[model samples]
Target: MVTIEPIMIKGHFFTAVTVCLPKTTLLTISNNTGYIMCGALDVGLLNSRLVDRKIIAGRAVGVKTIDELLMAPLESVTYEAEQHGIFSGMTGVEALLQMVG
Candidate 1:
């Protein structure tokens, strides 16, 4: 089963998605512009190598499971994100707010 719901944080609407599989649930939270604010601790996100010409802030969590990523502390971030004052060890929500600011 998959569920996607709208959540408001800091006056911004975000999409929260959860896909339940046989033994795992894939979860992610993103802003309206499709910038990933939080996601599972997957290699695709953790050690992402994709580089774009535009400087989009990206961040990853340090959870062992997908669900834990929801509240997990930030583990890594892109250089552009650093310029926005987003840093490792901060919560995902904190990073998002900083990015919006």
Candidate 2:
């Protein structure tokens, strides 16, 4: 199953997506500029192999839902995310705000 919905954070509009697979679910919240995702995201690949894309994203481990992903501290972030002031240990919400700002 796949679910996608609009989300409002501090008056900013974003999209939340949930995809249920056989054994796991993938969760992510995104705005025009960047996104935060569950552990399935590969921050290392974004930073190294896909560095030229300049993808601004963060990953939070042990997150089962979009809400948890939004509240959890980021386990890792892309280099582009770091350029935007989003860092490991930052809450997903905070990183998102930084991405927008």
Off by over 4 Å in 1: 33-48, 53-70
The number of the candidate with the highest TM-score is 2
- What are the Cα lDDT values of the candidates? 0.58, 0.93
Q: Put down candidate 1 lDDT per residue, 22-78, tens digits, no spaces.
A: 855666667633344344433344335653533444445444333455456776666
What TM-score goes with each of the models?
0.66, 0.97
Show the lowest summed lDDT stretch of 10 residues, model 2: 92-101
Clashing pairs in 1: none
What CA RMSD would candidate 2 show?
0.6
